[model samples]
Target chain A: MKHTVTLILLMLFFAVPAGVLVLISLASGWRFPDVWPAGFSFSGIALFLQQKEQILSSLASSFVFSLLTVGVTFFMCLVPAAVFARNDFRGKTVLEGLLLTPALVPPMTFAMGLHFFFIKLSLADTLPGVVLILAIFSYPYMFRALVAGFQTMGEHYRICARNLGAGPFSILWQVELPLLMPAVVAGGSVVFLVAFSEYFLVFLIGGGRVASFTGLLMPLLSSSNRSLAALLTLIFLLLPVGLFFILDLSLMRSFRKKGMA
Target chain B: MSWTNNRAGRLVSGLAPLLLPYLVLFCGGIMLTICQSFGVFTPLPHAGAALDAYAKILTDPAFFSSFGFSLGVAMVSAFCTMAAGTFLAYQVWQLPAKLATAALIYKIPLILPHISVAFVVLVFWSPSGIVASIAHSLGIIQTMQDFPNILYSGWGLGMVLAYTLKGTPFAMLLVLALLVRFDVRQIQTAAMLGASGVRIFFSIVLPRMAPAMHTSFIILFLYGFGAFDIPFVLGESRPGMLSIHVYNLYFKHDLARRPEAMAILTMMFFFAVIFIIAYSKTVQRLENGVRKL
Candidate 1:
């Protein structure tokens, strides 16, 4: 009983930052020295809703970038994993080592290099430029997960998939994909979260012309209208979590209907 | 065989769009920046080739200080984090099976936003922050104002502490992942064969853990070296950490010397990649050694 109470309390504590942010977003004021916000309001909510267009555009960019990242990550791990699982290649060990290299390197430093390159290519200030710089550069965890999935899923599944008279596309869509989904979902979130919260590269490469949520928050941080910043933080932070939940639900439900879940 | 080839081709075709973007991102972008570092920062940058940028940046006294400071703090923090993280992981590892879910709960900070982390550090470590408040209440300090201003001291010790707190759970999580798959039966048998717990751990578990520890150290070091948030909000403005300095050169200064900054960034990237390669090799070597043993 004691352990159960402690566990529940600990879980509650774990969720406080996000919960506080949500409360602040809903509340009209959260002045310092108060244990809680003064009260809740929808007046400020309307103003935030008014900023929806700007938010939507940035959100759209975030989605597109995330999709591009997930796609790249899936394949980068897929090819080598396929090769490695089937038969040995020369320098196989070295290629395996090289594949994991992206995860070990610091992102900001990598971002800096990409920023420089993008500037030279005249892509530095554009979405494609940011995409080229930011997408799938450092995601070793994803590689580890996907490669393990592909290797372990093996030749038998493919043969079985073929024997079912399932076309290659159908086999991939129906068979390999279901097995890979958990790895992809798990890997995808790690990459997506890192990219979403990523500060240096996006800011530098985007060159202030591209106003991301984090980028937009930069000016207000100097002033720190605590209530407002907290509200903005809540909203900005939840956007990713919210999208992820919706995706998870839809994916799970779709899979469940198809008896894949 | 044709069907297999056809299927493989389809897989490749399906995968191409995803793979191509990363190639352009990582390879093209990185090499371009590295090459641009040699180029003069013409507004066009197409004017090309400036040894001057490299020479001038290398010659800057402040640049060297910042670089050393960044590297040194990272080293200090990484070492400290490894110790604390190992201890914490051990403590968590000893938990009852029923409380395994609760053990995972102790690791909330690993998933906590970096901004919240910065905020927490600010709130706790500021002289007018939590520590000061506690000391004042204890009569150890007359006022919060009289308490030490650890955050902006330029020594980066406080910032490193904050970084360690933010980083420890992550290191611990990685350690936990390794420990989950670990075979403990032999270690127990060794304990039954008259080995002390400490000896079994040092001889058996530590070697088993070396690769993951090395990977963790590299990750912690990289994170510290390129840490932008904790340092940005906490470090003194004049202290000139490398990332901070590069940022200033780009945005605040808005100079044509972006290429100069790029030169430093390229050096950073080179060292980072070298470290990654070395760490990966060490892990591979350790894995092979373990397998052989």
Candidate 2:
């Protein structure tokens, strides 16, 4: 009885929403008093294919900026993450907390201010500007993940590398980077998801100049085209899930090959 | 002294990469917002006093209504998310190993973007939506139009539903992280005692979950309060979310009212900061007092 209750609850919460989305995406003129969609049609999928070029370009743009944000955040957080992990300076807690505030506070609060600054610097409405803003907003996740990564890694590797006459640069490249891959992936996934899904920040900074998947989808979402909106949302769900699945598989394979799993 | 100085320099240089952008972007942006709120960095020259924007915002009854409405929606949604998440997590945790693994389905919503979740809510709950359709077919409602206009009923219930939908999994993730380490033996022992199930949950389990509950509450509550995406899709315009308010003032209105937008953002930033401080302090005090009890 208990198990049955749990299963029912799980299905209600998890399966129902997804099932509704799938049904809506395929339904033609699905309307009131129809317990199910009126009839299945290829209209949504047809529309997606018809506008494939524009849709694909926006997807690619979102992908590129999100990946660039990940790269920028990785670089920004690497040394600082190491410093934070290894040291216990005065006011360290306060400083770390302060740095992590971006993650906690609403981006809308500071984004307007940054928009003004970006406009002054000619960074607004540029791809680099979008990447920079996203990186700035999201680097804290990478910072925290890397700090944990470095702590788990410990100082022993660096010390051993120095004993072997390796310089700091070589040690970081050859030794620390491989072990930190998991942390990077973890952090990068979050940063990617955030950047990919963000609508307002890109809209504000890009000034309609930037092509983003979210930008393309936001207007359509509110339109009368329910089928198309549902189709695009499904695609939005699929891309990240597919990427993470592949990532997880490859990480597992690599770990197994290295006898680390 | 030289050794310490060198160490200090190394630390500073090491942190510079992260600190540079943070200072220039995050701190600088906030400083600019505060300055703009005071009529210092307006697009056009401002002749008014520094506090004029603040005075304007404080005087406008719309601002207070929006603020109160945002607070209410956030609080209600966050509470619902926490309650549902905690209950579901406990259930999932108690399941047998295989069934528990199946319950991992709850994390699906966590992967979904906020906008997508809002879309999901729209697809499911709008007047002509799935639930209403089902109800109409089942004779529960005479017509689809007879379905309650729950989405735009002006109480922000639609936004609450959306937030709770998106947030419950997040709350579950946090709670389950702590729950995985919790020994089942404690529960068995408590059950062996004369304690009722409710008593056991409140006494033994609830305390263990309290820290995670508090943390997730702060995060979820603040997110619901300040987030734009969910509110954008589901929010009513009159006395809309504060984020929407800021967006309208900044973008929709003229450049002259930029300070007013900045003022709202400035107030939100301060409110978030104070909320965090006060919340942590209150939690700390309550926890200490509980320990004494």
DockQ of 2: 0.69
- TM-score per prediction, in order, is 0.81, 0.95
lDDT tens digits, residues B1-293, model 1?
Answer: 46546755655454455346546655555666676677733344544446767788889888888899999888988978776676566556656787876666555555544655565566456675555766766778886568777877778867687677767777777677677767878788998899997898788877766666776788899878876766776666656567788777766665567677777877888888878777767778766855665
Contacts from the true interface found in each model, as a fraction, amount to 0.34, 0.65
Model 1, residue B80: C-alpha shift (Å): 2.9
Candidate 2 chain B worst ten-residue window by lDDT? B284-293
Q: For model 2 chain A, where is the 10-residue window of minimal lDDT?
A: A92-101
DockQ, in order, for the candidates? 0.32, 0.69
Task: Highest TM-score: give the candidate number.
Answer: 2
Candidate 2 regions exceeding 4 Å error are B1-5, B278-293
Off by over 4 Å in 1: A1-64, A75-81, A84-87, A106-122, A231-261, B1-23, B40-50, B190-203, B254-256, B289-293
User: What TM-score would chain B receive for each of the candidates shown?
Assistant: 0.87, 0.92
Displacement of the residue B63 alpha carbon in candidate 1, Å:
1.7
